[model samples]
Target chain A: MKDILTIIFRLTVACLLAGLVMGTVFIATDKAKKHNVHVNEQKVMLSLLGYSAKNPAPASVAMHEVYRYLVGEGEALAMGYLLPLRDGSFSFVTIDLAGGFVAQNPVTLAAEKAGEAEARTAAIAVALGADKPLRYADQTIVVTDGGKRTAYLLPGKFPGFKTFIGAILAIDPDFSILGLEIMEHEEDPGLGAEIDQEYFKNQFKGKPLETVKKLEVVKTPLPEEYLKALEAEKSGLGAAEVASIQKQYQDKDIYALTGATISSRSVTNGVKAMVKKFAYRLAILDRVLAEQHIATPF
Target chain B: MATDKTNLQLVVNGILNENPIFRLVLSMCPAVGISTTVMNGFMLGIAVLFVQVCSSCTIALFKNVIHPRIRIPTYTLTIATWVTVIDMVLAAYLPEAYAKMGIFIKLIVAFAIITMRLEMFASKESVNASFWDGIGMGLGFMFGMMALGFVRELLGMGTLLGYDVLGFKPLLFFVLPLAGFFCVGLMMAFFNYIEIVYKRAKRA
Candidate 1:
């Protein structure tokens, strides 16, 4: 009995001592570690935005510069009006006054609307800097200076071999892809890591979203009609012919990775979904811009 | 088991005779986890060496006062404390290595080999003997892990550390955890073959 008690007592003391030492060490190093994490997060964000700097200068300086260059001198109202959803959610629906793309966050709206109406309203109130809870029908406008071209934030799910990989696909108003930034993935490195490469991502850029309707993985050389349509579209002279031309080439196939069929298909489907979602939003944006008499450069 | 052994014998024993991974087959978790890259294996090995040496000395000194029933837990606490210290120092000085090692550094607490040595040998032996034993065992673990890491990194990624040795056409399958099974299997078989030949020669 005495021996057992002694063992327990010794173990408890040892554990306490170990905890104290570890706690002290962690506390001493917490500041430096937090700074590293902050820096790394900024680096990932910059990479997603296609900024090629290997290492950003510093958080305060780099973030300020990025905001200045991207946001420009325009105040929040100059960007566009905020749309409150039925669930009391809000979006910064901006059409670029400059001749570029527009940006919208559909996921953010969907996330806010995911519960009871009252809960969602409460969440929105917190998000929008309001002390009192607002109803879904309330007309509350929060303003911000929107400078960058608006890209439709499409939810992307690529193939990860083990599971469906999720990402955020940013697309331009004309249905062309702006970027495919991976938000989450469980893919193996050197193989799935290839998805993050610029070459693969660049292929989706400038391609019409409608191309994903009948997506197929084929060899690189598309059919002759598709090539002709592409040339005609590039020339911009055959506007009348573009509809039929696009329809015929719509069923055309795209090249897939040699051995990685699942990964290829996932990317193809992910792109398709983004295109479909963006196409719907583009129509809405076009109507809103025309109705509001907003002069869009695009 | 050699009592009157010189320093060279102790080193040789660590490298060959009583290798922590192949012979004792201890601390298999970190050995496999950090063995994905040569640099990771090297860094982890050095860290383990420091912890083992320091913990062994401390445990051996306190062996007299520590009750027999609580010896295991006491040893574990000492090892855990040392590992936490090593983890902090690495995080401060070598952030890159710290990131690469990831959760494996914290896992050093559960590395059975360190605690096993402390309880089995260090607690019973003199401080000097325990110190040498710790060094020997730590080196043995390091050798095994490094060997596994070298082969895996070379074959899997076509690189040593992060350098592209061959033209960077990596065998992607080799980077996955499944690849570790094949590597350890082949190495074990090779060791067994060598052992068989050595036994046959001794009999002859």
Candidate 2:
């Protein structure tokens, strides 16, 4: 009994020491880690829009962050978009469950608080001047080029083979997919993880929002011609040939990775759902903005 | 009790006679999984090296006070603490590498190579000796991983650290899990053969 007690005591001491050490490290590195993640995410957004270190995004390019929130509960539920106005302030535009404009309220939320969902929600609750339960849903970035909207960079997440796969989808003004950049995933390497490869991810490029809404994953092997076209930049194919190939398979289903059907299907379904929902929300937002004569930078 | 070996011997033993991957046959899982690319192998090796050294030194320092019956748990706690610290540091400073080696870094806590060294050497040795052993073992593991990565990436994808060396893939089979095992087996045989031949030549 005494031996058992001693063992337990020793184990507890070790646990305490481990807890203390980990806590200190977490506190020390938390801010830096968050900053790094934010920087990497910004880089991804720029790259997805065809900007890179070598060919930097133009000085006229502007990225406006828009936050989405699920407001209220049950029957009183509504969707709110915290939009940036042309004058550099913010407004919370609320739409009812039936896609009707409900209310618009000017809200003040610090830019740094964007990473903290609770803080954003609290700020929104105060602005709403109501007891409605609010939950921050997701964020979309509007990329503009000198007062002209270029692309919508939407962040999305869905379950992959192992865990959730986080990705950023860039869409043009007409809702055509500009590119897909996989940010995070735990899918098996050389199999499911191939989704991040250029050939696989670039397949989504040029796909319109309408086609993406019905996109499906086919188990058929990706054709040699199609694969070559998908890798046009590397294979040195002319822009005309790339466009022809894309047009040829524009309506066809996404070809699943060789042995990663689940992963392929997950991405296809996730992209479809995200694009469809975003289109609906944007339509409502546009209607509400027009009726209220409120000019948003987005 | 195993601390009789000189510092140099401990390191040499880890890299050659008692290689964690080839001779000791420890940590085969990661050695096979992440060794598909040389960069990945090197990154994982660095993370493992940091954790192993920290855990071994911590264990050696506290061995006297830790109860013998509960030593395993204490060693595990030390390893987990160090692994978390390294994981956080990597994510903060080297986000690119962290993204590539996300879950694998956390899995380091369960590596048998670490626990085995802590049990067989660190728990018995002086703090200074254990520290050297950890270095030796860490470097040996890193060497093994890089060697496997070098072979696998070259043959599997005809690339060396993402550069196209051969211009065409030599064998796609080498990139698969089966090929990983085959490469490990072949390398193991090659190491053993060299050892046998070296011993015979020395005797002559």
Candidate 3:
């Protein structure tokens, strides 16, 4: 019994040392670790809207921080904050559209509860196989140009054929897709995972809201006109020809991945649902701000 | 089993005699899973190298002090601690690389080759021997994965490290896990054949 107790005591000391060592390392690096996560988060958002070409937040962003808090609060929206540039135009503004009432911190996730009325509707949509119910607990950052909202980088999640796919949707003023990027996904690498490639994502660009509303991933080859337009554009067709082709394909549904139709449809329908909610938020934010004019902070 | 072996011999043992992927046939999962792309393989190999070395050193230092009955749990704790630190460090310092290979790094904590080293070599070995053994085994694993990745990426995707290589049509079969097994087998056989030829020549 004494020998057993001694062995246990020795093992306990070893485990204690291990814990202490790890604890020390964690304490030493905890600040930098958090900073890296935050920077990466910003980098993802910036890249979604075409700010940086790669990871690591660009020095321009850190050095020339452009926006300042301009006041605004939403009545119908959960929470809102406006950041206007030095020129008195809203450069970057973030708003929480998921919650029904305004709150101080946009990070407050008061309305994300599944039992909430809004969440119930989304849960029903999810049951109907629309992308996972929109639990966008964080503020959606809107990037504006010259007082006009140019793009929105909204984070969303959708249930892929295998697992939930996390993504950031970049949409233009009229809800035309700027781009879609897969942040995290567990689909078959070559098949379902190809959704991350630019070729698959590029098809969504310039596709307007009306088309995305009824978007279906059809297995049939693209229409001859659309194919010709794509070819003509690639062959550097003349300005008139390119413009005509661009116009023709502007509102068309996206082509499905040859083998992975379900993954393709998930992204399309997921974006459609998220955008519908985002449009609602934009409308609420616009009316609320226009009535208050609180964005004009000196 | 011999503790008196020189550090160089121990290192060479890992690289040649006990190569994790080729000879010992350890860590076949990562060897096949991430070898679809040269970049992925290379990144995962580096993560493995880092974890393997750290775990080996820690295990060697505590070999005598750790009780035999609890060695397995102790080794696991040590490996898990190092892996957690690495996972955190990658996320903190190399976010982009972390984003690409973070899942792979976490997966390495459970890798057969990593734990196998502690069981077979590090537990009773000298600190220097254990460290060199890790270096050799890790490098051997890295090289093997890279070679597999190169061939798979070249033929399966017509790309090398994401760059277009030959203008030939990609062989899709080569990118699948099924082809990975075939490649590994072919490589093992080829190496064995070379060794047989060398031995015959030496005897003659």
Candidate 4:
């Protein structure tokens, strides 16, 4: 019908106009948006290690980004780490199924490009050659102060109430939790989203790997004293008092958010899995590095 | 001459009589969800206002060409485009606020209030009238959200915009979704009461 044709034509025009406007705006803001995302991520990474805008990280404190790759399948399964060397270049170190050094190849890419997954995938394909099946896994950051390794930052995700919740976990050399920062989530606001609140996030701090692995979600209400201690910075509690309170509840199960038990459990499980996997992977990487006599930035 | 007075009335009507939330009872999702905090409510309100105004203006400008049968789809596309533009702009320029309000911005496309305004008001009105209507409805929605947020935050969290006013939580139940319903209901009753009183006084 003529009427139908007119409706279709008008809708098409509207679509084209909308697309054109969005395209222009996207192009205009693309650079600034990317820059903001990068800066915000950097701020989060630094803050997890006790550095903030007020007290900037010292030059001596360097954060090195190390990427993980799961290569091959079945018996041929191997783990590869794209590590930073002291010489300002990167190397892909592979450990085979038996945890023995397989091969090491130089990965040449700009530092920023290497940090991004797509670019890293291409570089990996180039460095490892065509025959190997490999996929980019995850990335971790190592914080070193004056060449002494201090902490490790792991970005992890797990199934939340609605979708996966992304979080960054900071751990010391001994694999004790330094802090947790919820990066992104689609959980219900005023409920599961409370996981990002200070009191909830601070509960993960000071938890050792043993405690973290055994952490459970308790449905009981969070105690007032525990809440105050967890939010010590805001509560104006002294360091000694905070430490004491932390020690008291260091091994206690995580108190579930009043109405978001699933979300609380999800995060607890995520932290446990992330810590366990990182510890296992790092142990293998460290041993291989020592045996191969290869120096790493971390 | 008469047009000037009607334009002002449109705005006033939006605020008091046909308030998007209180009177018409539209977009209860964000109302109950994000109204837990004043800042959250205010941020969402601003984003909604931008999208509403932009979409209404676009609809009014092209209403002649837009076939009545397909006007709904056109309105949706217009809203979607504007939401994306606003999302990118906020993410780029106001990343700090965007950090808190990013999800809410994307969720604006689903809001019934925007579509309702386009269909009922903007589609038939002049560009100038549609613009004023957009301003009125947008402001009414914002005021409604802020009022809900104010009551919810005050009683729910014992805080106003994250500041502890009561020093301690008075009623923890107010922070829950269940309380959102009760608060909206009470507020609606209070608004109706005020309107009746004002009408009586004016008649006297």
lDDT of 3 at A41: 64
Over A204-269, each residue of candidate 3 has an lDDT whose tens digit, in order, gives 767788887777776877665555555554555676875577677677677887789999989888
Tens digits of per-residue lDDT for model 3, B73-138: 777788888888888777777777777888888888778898889999899887888898888888
Question: Measured with DockQ on alpha carbons, how good is candidate 4?
Answer: 0.81
Candidate 1, residue A229: the lDDT equals: 48
Interface RMSD of each: 1.6, 0.9, 1.2, 0.7
What's the TM-score of each model vs. the native?
A: 0.53, 0.93, 0.74, 0.89
Best by DockQ: 2
Q: What docking grade applies to model 4?
A: high
**Clash pairs detected, candidate 4:** none
Which residue pairs in candidate 1 have backbone atoms (N, alpha carbon, C) closer than 3 angstroms, thus clashing?
A76-A144, A76-A145, A101-A150, A102-A150, A102-A151, A103-A150, A103-A151, A218-A254
Can you list the residue pairs that collide in candidate 2?
A: none
Q: In CAPRI terms, where does candidate 1 land? A: acceptable
Q: Is candidate 2 or candidate 4 better by TM-score?
A: 2
Each candidate's DockQ: 0.45, 0.81, 0.59, 0.81
- Which stretches in model 4 have alpha-carbon errors above 4 Å? A16-31, A73-75, B1-13, B16-18, B22-25, B32-37, B155-158, B166-204
lDDT of model 1, residue A147? 31
- Score chain A of each prediction against the true chain A by TM-score and list the results: 0.44, 0.94, 0.59, 0.95
- Candidate 1 structure quality by residue, lDDT tens digits, A1-298: 8877877887787788779988998888876776665465445445544555765433332221100012222343223324544344444344454423355433243543432345544444444445422233212111112433434444446556678776656555465555566645655555655555543443454456566666666646444554454456345537567557655544455445545556656777777865774466446555765665443322
Candidate order, TM-score descending: 2, 4, 3, 1
DockQ of 2: 0.81
Can you write out model 4's per-residue Cα lDDT over A1-298, one digit (the tens) per residue?
Answer: 9988887788788889999999999999998998997788788989998888899999999888988889983457898889988888889998886888989999888887876678888888799887789988888999999999999999878888899999999999999999999988989877999999999999999998889888899988888888998888788988898899889989888999998989999999999899988998889889999898788867
The DockQ value obtained for model 3 is 0.59
